[model samples]
Target: MSVRRRASSVSLSRYARPGTPDYVTPPGDFCNAFWGLGDSGVDVLFARMRCAMTTTEELMSFWKERAILEERYARGLADLARFTIGKHEIGEMRGALDTLKNETAKQAEAHLIVANGIKTGLETPTLEFLRKQQQHRREKLTAVDKELKMKRNQEGYVVRAREKYEADCNRIKDFAAQSVLLQGVELDRLRIKHQRTLETVQANRRDYANFVRGLQEATQRWEDHWRAFCDGCQDLEEERIEFLFNNVWAYTDAVSTVCVSVDNSCEIVRLALEQLETEKEIGAFLRTYGTGNVMPDPPPFIDFENPDLQYDPSQPPSSHPANYPRQSHRFPTEDAANRNSVGSPTLSINARRASMTLFQPSAVNGRNGTARPPQAVQGGGSIPQSPSSQQRYSGGSNGSHPSHPPHAPPQQPPPPVPLQPQPQYPHPQPSNLSTPAPAHVPTSALATAAATAPAAPCPARTYTPIFFSLSPVQAIFGYTATTEEEFDFQKGDIIAVTATPPDGWWSGELLDDTRRQPGHNVFPSNFVALLM
Candidate 1:
C-alpha cells in the first residue's frame, strides 16, 4: 500500500515580521506571580527570562561587533583600492583597470555606508532600547515591591488594632458586671468606669476600622500598579523582540546592498578582462625583446695557447687559415725547413741506392756489348745537377781521387777490379737533337769533363732515373701525353707513402730503386734502428 504524504509547504522568508506589543492579561495578581506557583516556579521563570534577555543582548552585541568588522573592512578595502595593479597595462586594459579601481572604491564606500547604517539605525537603537528596558524594568519592580512592603506593614498594623479593640471591649464588659453587683458609692464608681471603658472601646474600634480600610486601599493600588507594570514590561519585552527583528532585517538589507555593490565592482573587473588582448601583448613583447629571426652560429674550436689565432665565428671554417698539412709517412731530409712542396717550381727529391755494385761501362746498359757515350741535347741546355751529385761523380783526368767536402763523411770506394777497356763516346752535334746517346760512357773521362762543366752529370752507366707521377716532374721530363685528371686530394689527406723497410731491414743504409746507396745518414731517423 502506498503511503500518501502531505505536500511540503513553501520555505518561509529568512526575514521575520516585527510583532510588537503582544499584550497578555495579568495572571491573577501580578505582584504575587513569583510566589503564586511557589519559589521553585519563580526560579524557573527567572532563569528563562534571564536566558531570553541574554539571547537578545548577545544578538545586539554580535551585530555591533559585525558592524565594527564591516567598518574596518571598508577602510582597508578603500586603502587597497588606492593602490595600483598591473601598472604596466596598456591600451584599453589601462582604462579598464582604472575603471575597476574606481568601481572598487565605490564598493568600499558602499560598505562603509552599510556599517554606519548598522551602527546608527540597528545596533545603536537596539542597544539603547535594551538599556532603557533594563532601567524601566528595575524601576517598575522597585515600585511594586515598595508598595507590597507597605501593604504588609499595614496588615501588621490592622492586627494590632484588632487586638487593642478586643481588649477594650472585654474591659468594658468587666466594668458592666461590676456595675450590676455594687450599690451606693461603689455603684457610682462602677458606672463611671463603665462609661470610660465604653468610650475607650469606641475609640479603638474606629482606629481599627480606619487601619483595615487603609490596608484594603493599599492592596488595591499595589495590585493595579503591579498589573500595569507587568503589562508595561511585557510590552517592552515584545518591543525589544520586534525592534531586534527589525534591526536584523536592517542588517540583512545593509549586507545585501553591500553585496550587490561588490558584485557591481566585480562586473567592472569583468569588463577589464574582456578588453584584455593577450595575444597582442605577447606578440609585442616577443618583437621587442627577441634577439633576431635567425639562429646564432655554433661556437668554433679555439686554441688555448693562441686564442687570438682562432677563426672568426662569422666566417666559414674553410675561410679560416687552418692550412692543415697532409698526413704521410715522410722521410724528411736533413734540411727540413728548406724542403720544397711537390708543387714548388724546383723540387729536389733526394733518393738513395744502397749496397749494389756497378759494372764497367762496357758491360752495363750496352747494346750487344757495345758502349755509347752521353751527349748534350740540341736545343735544351746541359741539365743541371745538384751539388751532392757533383761530389759523387767528380774525378780528375790525371787519375787522382778528389777529397770529400769537410762536412760530408768520407765515402768508402768500391773494391778495385782488373782494368777493362772502356768504349769511347762521340761528341753530340746540335742538328741531331733526337739522336740517342749511348747508355754508358767512360767513367774517368766523363767525370773529368763533368768536373769542368757547370754541374756534373753521372758518368752514364747502368743507373736509371726513377720516374715520378708528379705533373711538374713529368713536364720537366717532356711528358705531355694526357690531360685527364689523375688524382684527387683534400686538406689533411694523405697522397702517398714513401718506401717502408721490409721487416728484416735492421742494419743497412736506405736504398733507392736502383739498389744502390743514396748517401750515409739520409734516412728518416725515426724509421731506422740505431746501431749499438
Candidate 2:
C-alpha cells in the first residue's frame, strides 16, 4: 500500500480533496473499516462523538447542580436538627434553672426557719419569764435576809431582858434565902426565864437557816435556767450556720452544672457548623473533570535532536533508542536478586549473622550460658547488639571462658540427627469394630455444620419502663390537687405520678416529705411535662 504522511496540524480538507494523491494508509483494521465508508460515515461518527461530548458536559452541569442542591438540602436539615436540639437543650436548661431557683428559695425559707429559731431562743418569752421570776426570787431572798436580821435583833433584845430579870431574881433569891421557902420560888422563876430566852434564840436561828436555804435553792434554779438558755441559743446558732452552709453549697453546685451544660451545648453547635462548612468546601472539588481552562499539551516528544541527549554510560549495554525494541530487562531475575541481596558487599549480611550468632541461646559458654563476644567485621563498627546480648558478650569478653567470637572464623553447624528406620507394625484396630469406616470430611465441614445447625430461639427481652417522678413540678408548671387525700406540695418538692387519667387529671403520690406526708395526689395532666 502506498501512504502519505503529513503534519497533524494540516487541514482535513486537503486530505479529502479529489485529484490529490495524498492517500494515507489506515493504521489498523478499525481505521480501515471506518475509512472504507468514505466521507459521510466518518462525518456521522464525528458528529456523534461531538454529541456525546456535549451530553457529557450537560451531565457534568446536572451533577454539579445536584450536588449543590443536595448540599443546600443537607445544610437545611442540619440547621433544622440543630435548631430542634438547641430548643430542646434550652428547654432543659430552663427547667434546670427553674428547679435550681425553687431549690434555692426553699433553702432560703429553711434558713429563715432556722434563723427564727435562733431569734426566738435569743428573745423568747419563756426565757424572759424565767429571767423575771429569777429576779423576783432574788428580791424575795433579800427581803427574807432583812426579816431574818430583824428577828435576830429581837432575839438579842429578849436575851438582854432575860439577863436583867435573872439578876433581879438572884437578888430576890438572896433576900429570900434569908427567909427559907421564898428562896426556892425565886430560883425556879429565874430558871424558867433563862429556858424561855434560850428557846426564842433557837427559833430565830432556825428561821434564818430556812431563809438561807430558800435563797440558795432559788439561785441554783436560776443558774440552771441561765445555762439552759445559753445552750439553746448555741444550738440554734449552729443549726442556722449549717443550713446557711448547705444552701450556699447547693446553689454553687447548681450554677456550676448549668455552666457545664451551656459549654457543652456551645461546643456541639460549633462542631456541627464546622462539619457542615468542611463538607460544603470539599463538595466543590469532588469532580475534577473538565475543570481546567485548557488541557495541557502532551509532554514534548523525546527531543532527539538535543545535544544533551548523549548516550548515558551508566545505562545497561542493551538499552535501546526510542522507536527501537528493548532486548534486556531492567531488574535482575528474582532468584539472582535474592541470592546476592543478602551477601552483597554493601549489605554486610555476614556482620548481621555475626551479631545474631553472638546472642543465640544455644551458642553459650558452658554452665552460665554467657554469650560469646562478636568478632570485628570487615566494616569498622562492631555489630549492634541488644542490651542483654551486650552484657553477656561483655561478661565473656574478659577471657575467663573458653568461647570463641562469632566472626573469628566460620564454623560448620552440627549435623542433623540421622533418620532411623522403624520396625513395621500393624496399625491399631479401630475403636468401634462394628462401625463402618468413617467417610472423609471436607475442610469446610465445621463451617457447613455450623451453617446447617438449627438456630436457637432468642429469649424475649423484658423492657422495664423507667418512671420519672417530677422534681419541683410546681416550680416549672401549675398543679392543684383535687382530692382530700391528695397532698399539696410546694416548689422543689418531688411529685410522683402513679397514673394518668383521660379526664385531664393524673393520680400521683407526693414524695415531698418535709411539708406533707407522702400520699396520692390527683392533678391535671398538663400540669407537668414528662421528663425524658
Best by TM-score: 1
Candidate lDDT (C-alpha), each: 0.47, 0.36
Top lDDT: which candidate number?
A: 1
Q: What would the per-residue lDDT of candidate 2 be over residues 245-308, giving only the tens digit for each residue?
A: 6544544544354444444444343323222222233444444332533434444445678889
RMSD to the true structure for each prediction, in A, is: 49.1, 50.8
Off by over 4 Å in 2: 1-98, 117-124, 134-141, 178-532
Candidate 1 segments exceeding 4 Å error: 1-60, 91-103, 131-143, 159-208, 274-277, 284-532
Worst-scoring 10-residue span by lDDT in model 1: 472-481
Tell me the tens digit of each residue's lDDT in model 1 across 22-106: 3424434323343332122233333434555666688788878988998999899899889987698655667777887888789
Q: Count the backbone clashes (under 3 Å) in each candidate.
A: 9, 0
